[model samples]
Target: MRKLVCVAAMLSLGVTQVTFSADLAGAKDHPLVSRFRGADAVGYGQADFGNARLPSGANGKHTDAAGRLTDIVYRAPPGKRAAEVFENYRQALAGAGFAISWQCGPGTRDDGCGGFRFAGDLADPVIATLKGDSSEMIKLLDATNNNVSYLIATLVKNGQTSTVALMVSQDDERPTGVLLRVIDAAPMAQGQVTVDAAAMAKGLAAEGKITLYGLHFATDSATLTPDSKQTLDEMAKALKAAPALKVYIVGHTDNTGALAHNEKLSQDRAAAVVKALTTTYGIAANRLAAKGLASYSPVAANTSEPGKAKNRRVEMVAQ
Candidate 1:
């Protein structure tokens, strides 16, 4: 027969068995500190360049210039002390051309450095992780002096600035933990409304409401950007073309803070737009009603940057 019997190799008396090692839990490290070892990753995330607030000095905070952010949380190998991990990271950062900005550690008064106050949907998970059965770890958090250690450093490379925060703490039981947040300042989403007044009018005429994208604003503020002039002029033209048309100006925001805060911000922004249309564009104040919808009426999902951008907008609704 064409098929022959296959013989399997017999085990030798002196043969050794080969085994492969498994990766440690959360072992991945960010590229900035890939050389340092001993900790396993427990959490990781990234966002396109955005503002980061870092502890400045005692009882103060500094806002980093906009940049990409890479956040990582790691659990230290057993027997690794918090102080040891902090010092090691400090040295490593310095060696990598980073200048120390601020540091808080044991023996320092509680100044609220290195602690994070998460907002919006991100709060529950972060709070649970920080507060769960780990009294020692909680005490070691930024702003507490229960043996917590944290460092902030700045690095400038290729005409771009980057900031890093390394906070370390110990758990009550086995493994210690470290939170590493890095922000690399880089170009991000451009704030400019490209849609003209005709398009806005057409959309409103057909859909009863039109979302405006070109109304730019400063971060966390209602002040309109100078570049918003084009969009504003177009909106004015549309209002002039339909003198009898009354519309409701609605402002919206992304889900990034407490519901109340976001609602108030949206209201303020809507009022600002109404004021601009009246004073700057000569649109009659009575023809426009301002309202803030906050994040309740979203046109897209809130899980991604594009969705968040879409949600942060102003709409003209025919009344």
Candidate 2:
């Protein structure tokens, strides 16, 4: 339901000349921010629930957030300067009652907004979110020049806040490019986006267990988040479908913290699931068991954040 407030005036897309002709397939403007006229959307990606770590101000600080995330990469019309493009976005956010939390670039009165260091910090994290054929467009941010400008702006309305990050950078040889990442604070729409009971049953029947990534918990916590309701609903339905089946709710964690702490944390999580099924959904407590693997049975390596995420999951195993 969050929409970018409309700018009072359309941004001037200086000297309209084409560099890229087509937008990426299935790519479109995010509802919050309209595209700059004549710009080509070379890269785009969105997730129902995700995190984006964007800078807030100078010196490696960030406006890290998790919510409905969208990444939009654009190549400005030929003859358009990166400074001009950045100004347009700045005004748009300002018109929408947003506050510029951090801005940098020689062209932005911030010759040292940690350009060399910030670029190194943000480039990879930003690029990893891009899923377009022209992902190389992000390389423009690699430069530190008069044409480079970055801004992280935020808006708060009715007790909720959302974040938008804008960066305009042009490599010495490439056209001016813009990366717009927006994180709209929202609870994941439940019942609509999770695996259904039938699929959960199918997976369990085939593999003797089903890994449940949809069931989310805070870092090192046993309490399920609100977005996890739909997955838990499906789990309850699966239990109802087979009344006599014995199941084990097993939890696993990545090797991040102390061994004793992780072991207890994982056990508490598995117990929470069993508690939910037995109390909330009226399943028989005797028919279920709970256990914690505590990094001992990792499905993936624990070397990367993505891998650690994969290892921290709940599995429903058949007895």
Candidate 3:
């Protein structure tokens, strides 16, 4: 079993980037005010709580600029409290006209993990809302990689509203990671979280079990055949109908190659299915987990070519 790494230190980097429909010209302003152009003429004020290293040479330096109510950059070191950093920014923005409409950070779960091993603390994203009642919702974006963090706040004053955001990031050369964006919790005029409940029902139909079918592979290799696309198409249909339903996509192999190699090949095949689902069908990043089972979980005999073909398959178990 792959032991879970300690992630307590990841709490310090809790925040993600906020992208606009168009790049805001005043994004670098001291207080960071952004305007949604054209018919979307609404302007927003922002605050970033990411523990990213800024030019301050220390943590919690507040600077004032045009459009920015207050800009505070905090570089919290290991063994330090990020709440202290957030308090400083709170004070600065308070001096201005903004008050905390919402705030979010790592929870008790992040306490014992120690320090972060990845960037952005990207795995943990929390949203606090002052709806009719004050409530907080925390979401995890990626499980395999848990180093990214982000937070977003929406403050309202009379008829005007502004949004503040912060994100901490670390460099990972490969573009395979999770990203979270917080949407304001407003009463829906129609839909329930824009979720198609019927679709969700279809997705839950195959919750924990994986099914199989016979398919040929390349000689001496685990590479899938062109005919395998038919099975993949069925999997894609199930995913598309229920967009929010996430699954643990697994690949299994027959006992032909060495166990280690078979395991690796199975894992690769599983991930390939995930890529096709996400990129080709526009599935969200947080909804897929990929793994390889090797030949240990085979359902058929390796004695016959027909039986072995039945053992090589891609299986999905809803997470």
Best by TM-score: 2
lDDT (0-100) at residue 301 of candidate 1?
78
lDDT of 2 by residue, 122-234 (tens): 55566666777534665656554546678888777666666888877876767788888888776444334578899989988999998888888876689988888888899
The models' CA-based lDDT, in order, is: 0.65, 0.75, 0.42
Q: List the residue pairs that clash in candidate 2.
A: 4-32
Q: What is the lDDT of residue 133 in candidate 2?
A: 54
lDDT, residue 194, model 3: 22
Residue-pair clashes per candidate: 5, 1, 21
- Each candidate's TM vs. the true structure? 0.49, 0.56, 0.33
How does candidate 2 score on lDDT?
0.75
Per-residue lDDT for 62-131 in model 1, tens only?
5444568776566666676776777777776776788898887653333333343312112223324331
Model 1 lDDT at residue 66: 51
- How do these models rank on lDDT, best leading? 2, 1, 3
Quote the RMSD, in angstroms, for model 1: 16.2
Which stretch of 10 consecutive residues in model 3 shows the poorest summed lDDT? 129-138
